[model samples]
Target: MRRIIYDVAVSRDGFIAGSNGDVSIFPHTGDHVDAYNERLATYDTVIMGRHTYEFAYQYGLPAGAKAYPHMRHLIFSEGVQLPADAEVEAVRADFTTHISALKKEQGGDIYLCGGGMFAGLLATSKLIDVLRLKVAPVLCGVGTPLFANVSERIDLKCISSTLHESGVEYCEFNLQ
Candidate 1:
C-alpha cells in the first residue's frame, strides 16, 4: 500500500502556525529548504486541506509549480470550488474513499501538506503512515497545534534526523 505522509514544519512549541495563522515562523531557508524540496520530489501526488491550498496558492504556488511539475495536486475542500487548473484538483468527497482510489490509480506515495485540522483528522483515523516534521527554533505561544485534538497515542519510530545550519532540525517519524 502507498503511504500517506504528513510533511509539515512546526515551531518548537508544536504550533503549525501562529495565532493569526502565520506560518512565517517555519523555516524556509538554507539546507532545510533544500532537504524539504528534495523530499517532496519523491511523492507522485500532494494532498492538502483547503486552507493550506489557499495559503499555498497565495504564497507558494508559483514556486511550487516550478519545483514539483511532475506531481499531481489534490485539495480537499468542503464547499469551496476550485478553479479549472490543470495542476490542481479539488476533491469534495469522503477522504478515505478518494485517497484509496487515488492510491490505486496513482501508485506512489502521497504527501499530505496540511493545516493542523486536516492533519488531526488523518492522525485520528490512523491514515498517516509517516510524520515528517521540521522543528523550527522559534516558539508560538498559542496557535494552531501540529496535531490538534488527536487523542490516541500514535506510536512512531524515529527513522532519521538532521540538524540544518539555520537552526532547523528535520525529523522523520514512521508510524509503527
Candidate 2:
C-alpha cells in the first residue's frame, strides 16, 4: 500500500505559515531546500486542501494550473472552480473512500501537502502514515498551525533526525 506522508515544513512554534498564510519565512536556501527537492521524487501524488492548492499563487500557479507539475494533484474542495482540462483535479469522491482506494493502488507514496485543518482531519482519522517534518528555527507566533484541533495525541516514533546547516531540523516520524 502507498503510504500517506504528511511531508511539511514547520516553524519552531508549530505554525506552517504566518498569520497571512505567508510561508516565505522558512529558509529557502542551502541544504534544506536541496534535501526537500530530492524528497519530492518519492511521491507520485500530491494531496492538499483547496487553500493549499490555491496557495500556489505565490509560485505563479494560476487557478487552472497543477500544484505540482509531474505528480497527480488532488484538491479537496467543494466549491473551487477550474477548467475542464486543468492539471489539478477536485475531490469528487468520498474522502476516506477515495484515499483508501488510493492506498491500495500500486505506485509511489502520496503526500499530504497540508494547510493544518485538512491534515488534522486525516490525523484524527489515523490516515496519516508518517510525518516528514522540516522544522525551521524561526517561530510564527500566530499563523496557520502545523497541527490544529486534533482529537487525540497521535504518538509518533522517530525514524531519523538530521540537523542541517541552515538551522533546519529534518525529522521523520511514523505514527504509532
TM of each candidate vs. truth:
0.88, 0.96
Residue lDDT tens for model 2, 60-157:
88887876778998888787788888888888658777788888999999989987988998888788999999999998899998878886778999
- Any residue pairs clashing in model 1, and if so which? none
Worst 10 residues of 2 by lDDT: 92-101
Instruction: Supply the TM-score for candidate 1.
Output: 0.88
Q: After superposing candidate 2, which stretches have Cα over 4 Å from the reference?
A: none
47-104 per-residue lDDT for model 1 (tens digits)? 8887777776666565224225677888777864554544577788798778767766
Clashing residue pairs in candidate 2, if any?
none
Model 1 stretches with alpha carbons more than 4 Å out: 60-67
lDDT of each: 0.81, 0.88
